[model samples]
Target: MIKRKKIYIEALRILAIFLVLFQHVPAFDYYLQDTSHVMGHLFFTLIAKINVPLFLMISGSLLLNREEGYREIFRKRMIKIILAILIFNFLVYLAENQFVFDLQDYCLGVFENGIDRSYWYLYSYLGFLVMMPLLHRIAQKMTKNDFILILFIHFVFSTIEPLLQWFVPTYLGQSFEFTWAFRIPFSTIKEIFYPLMGYYIDRKIHIESIHKKTLAGLGCLSLLGILISMFFTIWIGNQEGFSDEYLELFDYVSALSAFILIKSFFVHYEAVIPAWISQKIVLLGSVTYGVYLWDPFFRKLFFDGFDQFMIPWVGGFFSSVLWCICSFLVCGILVQFLKRIPKVKSLF
Candidate 1:
């Protein structure tokens, strides 16, 4: 028998995914152009950084059950993820043009640029999923030394490689061409690190002893990570000013650290956060994958002809936020409806 702490896990998952939705819209950064405006921008950025790491860590923690073999795992996750990606892609395509099945174009486009936008991550994760069996087999023999060695390889191949390319001489550039760049997204250092962390955290770290210190640790690191990330953006921004457009290297690292610490804190304090709240988190988290797949519809709404009528920051921000929230709701609705349809339900 297994313990199902559904609410606690789900709550965080929902928070994580919706926050990702918030990131794409004007909801967070439109207001944070300068220090004088509001702290909401920095808050959003901080959350954005931590969010994916939390999601990935949770995946590592939750999916490490060895009873499921490669075939079974692929059937359960890989196919579902792919189908979900296609569903959203189709929705977005339809919403964007009021027409469907532009097979020639879609095929050529996918073959060429590789699915566009966030879907790229899905493709990358597909690669990761394929490697899971090998990873699992190696996991049995894993040690702290092995873990640190993996981290060092990640640093050399993922983090340091990029830095060296930007600064170093001729030969330092070749590592960039390696295929892991396409598959792992910064070497999946966190993915590799977190599952191993989970194994130890579950087996070694005592819940009670960690409670107070975990809270303090998460708080401090979250603050520190945000400050360092913001400093990178601000220090660079003032010289040229920060654009809320996209993320950078330091942003990813700080965000990764902040989220890891935060998740650990949450696990440490699981008993304190009321039952209702945990249920909400679990519900949202479960539905989040569907929402992710359905996001392109909302994305279409953002780029719709509404642009002609309102291009102002306030208008754009509100409209984008509305679309994103509505998209989450719509995705949830569609998923529920899809479950009732026997044919559609079978696909996932």
Candidate 2:
């Protein structure tokens, strides 16, 4: 296993995240909503898609070798996520000033109701947290033959999941009625297999011999995946033309595949960029979670009346980026403060 902390890997994580962030920029819809040309930022979806699964894959590779038992693993993983959910949801309630009725409604359907909006990611990730230990053990057991079987298990589950939800109908994701984030019980259980395959692949595949060539191959696959997904997204948008609700599901899957390919490229690459720019990117990327959470508020703060501001596109764009950075910094400070709070220290 690659034991040392690779700064480039960390950089890839942050970069993938920002692709998600920039893709969320409202200006893309503003510019490309009805045009022949797609916004550059729209490609962010293709790039950003890999962000989460890559994260999980990385987690699997890094954590599977740990010596901790199941109970210790569970405590280590779940406590912080569960606490984060509780604290963040409680804060959301306070901001909204209404009772969550013991999180009954929020748990039942946050996406559908749009009650506590940001908690969807929290719920889905928490679901992952709960299942990690079992997944790790499974990874340790599989032989060469078992690899294909494990992958088959993942493929079958992924294929049937969406169909079953629409036709047979069951509780697909977290208990939240609003959005499953598509991580249902079966899929969540099935999720155990992918990380192992990722871990398996990483361990068996030596990039040192053909780092440059493999990186090229991964880059091509990543490109192919993104182009196909972008076509699907753009096609649906133009013809079937956007089911804001359902299309996002396609987008998410596409993003995941692309992310994995990109991750492989970085992992296999020997030549990294300059330390100064890499460091800056990593720093910005470090604040990405906070940035994702707070970007909307920052947009509201700075860009609410951007067009009316007497300045040109340069001013407006800078304002948007600047406000995003400011928001990340502010949230970073808040996260730091939260870490200091005795009761809340564990949540981070």
Candidate 3:
């Protein structure tokens, strides 16, 4: 039987891809030191920060409640994921070779370093898949209070500790061994935290009964979180001669809140949608993984290609928007082509 799709998951996937694109806006990186473009940097950073968490949450919502055995999960779910990672890593090696000319070095680097930093999500997710059986085992045994308490600890370590470490040296004059202890836990917890939260919410919370104002309130808080992120970025950038990387732990609050709001929004509104638009939306959503894998390549292409045409005419912000749209269209078309290939379709 063909299983019915959840509207919210579809919506979340589409949202995540766009946010990922926003994060990659070339101007954000190139113009980070430009005071005039601070607003642009902050806007993109806020949306980009949410992309990975929301993507993981969507995966958790879809996969955590499944009845399949470990072997089946590996065979059915993870095989494709692993394949995609390998394929994309090879693609990245080829892309990077254009400048370095060292085929041997690039081959070794692909396994050690990411094909691109964006591919970090793929490896993180692969690890998450391996750990899911154990995670679900723990989740199944936990009481509501236990779940909340664990999440509290995760937040403290993942978000709070990192934020504190950034400012702690200025006050304390040096880093401590205890800081590393806290930091080490985040390396383990970071990948699974948002997904586990999504799973818990999907398996436990009832989103339909929640007041709509709750969602609205969370949406507002998300906006506030972005503004706070902006100020913090500027403040920290100035602190170290505009050389320090902008810190954005504040994204956790808004990312989690936005996930809940999006979930609730779809649950309440999805039922009234027309079939035509719904199918179209779901179709677009289906190609997101491919879009993510190919986007970096096309981003480089269009960003460079449009430099002469769009950048000169429209400026950086609008040129970036055009680049993003063109990348999306190209990726969508490419993914659809990949889907038709018998053996390769499964990788996407």
Candidate 4:
């Protein structure tokens, strides 16, 4: 029997993709340099930074619950992503290189650096797919406390330590080597935490048991945390030449909280959403991968042609929102068209 798509999940996917598009807006650099709108840029960019975390959480929520074997995973999941990467990368390469076909240059670009840096997620996701079976097994066996413990460990090594290293004065710190001191090497496991956290929340948490007031308070705090982090990021960037270490760390924390809050809100009120709207959300969500692959092309096309005209009047933030909306719509339509072609459909 075929399963029904959860509207809340689709909503999350839509939000994630829009955030991805918004974050990639070319005007960010312009805003960053503009004294008048730097804070606004920082605020929006911080929110946009949640895109990857949200996507990973969605993946975790959907994939961890399944019991697919290695063969099934490779055939059903990995192959498609691999093909998408190759095909889209080549398309991007051709576009960037003016349709020049150089096998040697193309191969070097593919191996040394991606032809399109936006496709980094596809390669990372391919790695995630390779490890999904093992991850699923661990996730299935994990108790709530085990999940929490892993999250805590990741938080310490990944978030807390990094922040401390950045803020602490170098003169006051001493390096001491201990043979028995062991660390989980969170640098490698950082990306793994989001999916695991997603599975934990989706499968283990009973949202109904929690009070609405409590959830609201947590959500408010999460928003505040995101804002505070953005402010600090701006301040530090101005003072210390703009390293994203602190902001990126806080992003993981904030994104997790935001994901939970958004998921809870959708779960509680999803039924009230009009059926027509939900259908559109699902349709848009379904085409997100394709849209994502094609977004940069449209983004450049639109931004280059229209940004100068719009920015001076409506300002940077609003102009970016407008561009993002247009880019998403165009990319969505393009993806739908491509999906109809038998030879190209598999890439999406």
Candidate 5:
């Protein structure tokens, strides 16, 4: 029997896609450069950085529980990703080239420079899928203590070290360098950690058992930590010229905490969500991948159009939000439509 859809997971998926759309909204970029609404834009951008990790975590939560063999994973998961890259990259190439298809240019774009910058996650995800079998094995064999140890190592290296490197010089007025001898590549660590945490949370921990007050406190603290880190990073950058170092919010402690808190909230209170709303969430969640692929194209369109008809009062964050909402709905609808077509459904 087909397993029933998890409403909370679907809710998180929808939220992730929305965050993705919000992050790519050009208004954030405009305001960041303008520096008038820097904090507001930066705050939202940092929060949105959780989008990719949340997606990865959700993947782990769903995928690690399965006992699918390598053949099934290849046939079902890997093939679809490969097809999406080929087909969507081609579409992106066509759009970029004004529908004048050039095989040479397309090949170069795919093999050399990426066709679209936004689809970087797809490539990363393809890598993750390649390693999923090993991840699954580890997930199956590992105890809770093992999972916790791995997460701790990831937290120390991925999150804590960076925070210290950023925080120490600015606040403490001292040089601090802490390097690990057995350094794992960050991309590999990220691919492993987020999903592993997701599996751990989903399988080992019971969200419903956690008190609501505790979760609330964590959520608040996480948000505060994220804002403070971002504020200081931006402030220091202004003082010492901008660097992408700690300002890159993904895999940060606060962001991960926020992700877990949000996940917990959804999972814990999932029963109270209205059935109608739950259904809607599932439907939208189903199309998030397609929406993600299609969003950048529409993002460009809406960004340009919004700029052309720019309203003075709504020029900043509000306009960016409007652009994201419009793009999300349009892309979601487009994806839903595409899903109905026989030839193109699978690729989408």
Candidate 6:
């Protein structure tokens, strides 16, 4: 028998999808470039950075505690993700082509990176799935303190060290490197860190705040992340011209805080939320996988023109927000229509 669904997981999934779409709403252009739009682009990109890690966290929260055997997990979960990559990548390829085939370009895209670069998450997530059993086993052996230490280590090596290396040379007139024995694995734990922490926080930590303090605190943390991102963008992005693509420590901390806050809120108040609203949230959440698959197509088809018109009228920020909302509505409807077919719907 299937286990009952968790409300917060669904809510978080919906939030993640919206943020993902928000990041994709074509905002930056030479014609639209201004201080406000540049600021908007920065804010949009910063918040949207949470989407992938949050998605992984959702998976960990729901699945890490499962009793299924590795074989079952591999067959049921890993295989499905692999199939999604193949199926969705094919659709992306077809959508990009106007009946003309470029075999060399197509092969390079599919083999080198992916059909659509955004689909790289699917591939990385496939690797995550393959490692889930090991991660689960490791997590089971870890205590709260141990996990906290892991997070600390991960932050220092993955985020702080990298940031220092990137910015220190400019400020200090020299590059700094750790002694050979003192060096840590820089980015090795990135994909696994948030997910493992998500499982730990969801299962082990029992949090409740009836006064909505958790949500308030998360809002504050998110704001702090924004400030940190702004500082870096103005300081480093200005100097470097925005080439580096590292997701910083503040982003992950803010994302984790928000993730925990939402989980706490839904856990404590799931019953108090109106059934209709809850059903709607869950319904949208159910189609997020499909939305992620089809959103780019709809964005190009519907929002491209809307963006050009709206960005000039309003600004990049609000235009993108409007585009994001339209994307959800259109993609939701599109997914619903596709779901009418039994076999085709399963691919999404």
Best by lDDT: 4
lDDT assessment of candidate 1: 0.58
Alpha-carbon RMSD of each model: 5.3, 7.5, 3.1, 3.1, 3.0, 3.5
**Which lDDT tens digits does candidate 1 get at residues 1-348?**
112345445655676777777776655576454466435566566566555655665565566546467898788878976775676566666666666669777666554533446565566567557766765666656666765665465546544555455344445544334444354432355555555544434433454465566556756755665565565556556666666433334444444444445455566667677766666566566677767766756676654654444556446556656666677887787776776888777552
Q: Candidate 1, TM-score vs. the true structure? A: 0.74
Record all residue pairs in model 5 with backbone atoms less than 3 Å apart, i.e. clashing.
none
lDDT of 2: 0.52
- Per-prediction TM-score, please? 0.74, 0.66, 0.87, 0.89, 0.88, 0.86
lDDT for each residue of candidate 6 in 1-348, tens digit (9 for 90 to 100): 111245677788888988887766654222125544556566666777788889988877777777667799778777777787766666677677853667687767777767877777788787777778777876676688877787788767756776787677868889787445664332245567777878877777766633576568678877886776666665665666653255364777777887878877677667778887778777888888888877766654556678779877886668878877877888788889988999777666
Best by TM-score: 4
Provide the clashing-pair count of each candidate structure. Answer: 7, 12, 0, 0, 0, 0
Q: Candidate 2's residue-wise lDDT over 108-173, tens digit each?
A: 444452335544655666565566666667667867777766545454444344435443433454
> By lDDT, highest first, what's the ranking?
4, 5, 6, 3, 1, 2
lDDT of each: 0.58, 0.52, 0.71, 0.74, 0.73, 0.72
* Tens digit per residue, CA lDDT, model 4, 1-348: 111337667777888899888877765444456646777666666777779888887888789889899999999899998777777777777777767788888777777647777778888888788778877887788797887788777767756676566556545576533233657632236457778888878788876576888787877766776776766677777887654555565666667777667667767776776778777877888888888888765554456567789988997667878987887888889888988999877777
Number of the candidate with higher TM-score, 3 or 4:
4
Evaluation by lDDT, superior candidate among 3 and 5: 5
Q: Lowest-lDDT window of 10 residues in candidate 5?
A: 1-10
Which candidate, 1 or 4, has the higher TM-score? 4
